[model samples]
Target: MKSSILASAAILAASLEPVAALSEPLQNILINTDRSPIYRYPTDVTRGIIPIPVHSHNDYWRDVPFYTALSAGCISIEADVFLFNDTLYVGHEESALTKERTLQSLYIEPLMSVLKKTNPKSPFVSGPTRHGVFDASSGQTLYLWIDVKNNGEKAWPHIIKALQPLRDANYLTKVQNNETFVPGPVTVIGTGGTPLSQVVSAADRDYFYDGPLKDLTGFTSLVSPIASTSLMEVVGDIKSDSENPLNPTQLEAIRKQIKAAKDKSIGVRYWETPGWPIRLRNELWRMLWKEGVALLNADDVNAAKEYF
Candidate 1:
């Protein structure tokens, strides 16, 4: 009985060895047979999403600032920044600022994180890459508009310092040798209280000025890649029920502004467009697109996304 038991145990062990040996190879075959090799590019984060020529107005108001606009396919985003104790705070007003919501926390750091992912280091990669947020269009550059809420001169330095992370990563679009405008993943435009002198003086600076759309005499892609103006200021208020949304005068103004900016190779954007009466708002959007507006300034990204 002992001999028989020993022989049976040896047979069982022998049988299990073949099963264990086959298991790993069989599993690998099962796992890899139908699936292709996994590969990923740096800008794959925004894969499958098509970008639109829309500016996310007051972008920080969203629950997820950078990501919200990115997901919505808005190529441009804005943040209102105020300097307090040498720290850059982001909000529409001073009352809206919180300690946690900062220029670094809200925009710079987040942008760096996204850019880093889009420009990863790998053996397969030959050299440096400047991939933008959009995987569908890797050449697309995200526009970051910084509106200085107060104390332009005092706040300017802080804004520059805050951008070091991006600058170090070569993620910010720059004017090299004061002539070559090399576009990176992100372009920073200083608006509101941002001084024109400061931006233009530094010919090779990464940041640019949001020049007056109504007057861009000396501005170029180097100093002002994009120019913006209020729609009401330039085109006047639209009558709520008027079939001719943009009258002859307003139409001419729109064409002139767009032509002026585009002639200088600078894009044009119009803010403070009518919001209420959904029909009129949509009609204006259509008209703006028809007029060849570079960016459609939109407070509501979801609605704007739907429009496109």
Candidate 2:
């Protein structure tokens, strides 16, 4: 009887091995990008069933509760860097400052540790496999959407200098001609009425211009024609109003804009949409997906993961 029991136990363990191997242990995964956190929901109303613990953002990095939402494999991550004095800190705006929350401490340090463990030879030793989109031999390429929150002329040089190490390693994506102006690896995405024409012309680097959906017609026609080889990311800042719960008109406008941009082979993203609140997010996603938008930026990763 003891011999029989031992054999049975061994057989059970062997049977379960494949299941265990197939299950990917969640370790800081993001659906589209690695910058945001993943959250979990008890039930998914849209799917008519409970999901396997959807991943979403948790402010746990800020002494908030650790949410159980699993990661949905984020391809890229965005970190907004503000250079104060000589230090670069990660925050969306200038007001949210804290001594312990420097860019290295908050975003770079932890991310580097993760990358080192996963892919030891990564150029970004501070964060490994975080941005898995680029070739390893080419070095890890991070979009590094550096929003020039400060003085563009002064701050731009400093930002480039700071990230010079990565550029030397060929980890940066650069435009053919404008190497001097728009430095490598870091794509300058402007916000709050930033004039990108001079920047694009001077640096010969591609950029993301934030404007209304309709306003994109002129910009795309003007910029894209001359810079045929250049890339442009048009970001539409749309919001929901009382009259429109999901902003159907804005969605339609975005669709048209994306179609036009695609014809030119440019990228697009819609910002300022409600990130959480499952119903609203799903609706927005459904619209964007239908329009064939490749990238979806979300403040919360888990909310975005549900649709996928």
Q: Which residue runs does candidate 1 get wrong by more than 4 Å?
A: 1-43
In the range 262-305, model 1's lDDT, one tens digit per residue, is 89998889999987788888899999899888899888888999
CA lDDT for candidate 1: 0.88
Which residue pairs collide, candidate 1? 42-118
The Cα error of candidate 1 at residue 95, in Å, is: 0.8
Relative to the unseen true structure, what is the C-alpha lDDT of residue 242 in candidate 1, on a scale of 0 to 100?
A: 80
- In the order shown, what is each candidate's alpha-carbon RMSD? 11.3, 12.7
Q: Which candidate comes out best when scored by TM-score?
A: 1
Strongest candidate by lDDT: 1
C-alpha-based local distance difference test score of model 2: 0.45
In candidate 2, where is summed lDDT lowest over 10 consecutive residues?
224-233
Clashes of each: 1, 21
* Candidate 2 regions with alpha-carbon error over 4 angstroms: 1-71, 108-142, 178-198, 201-214, 217-251
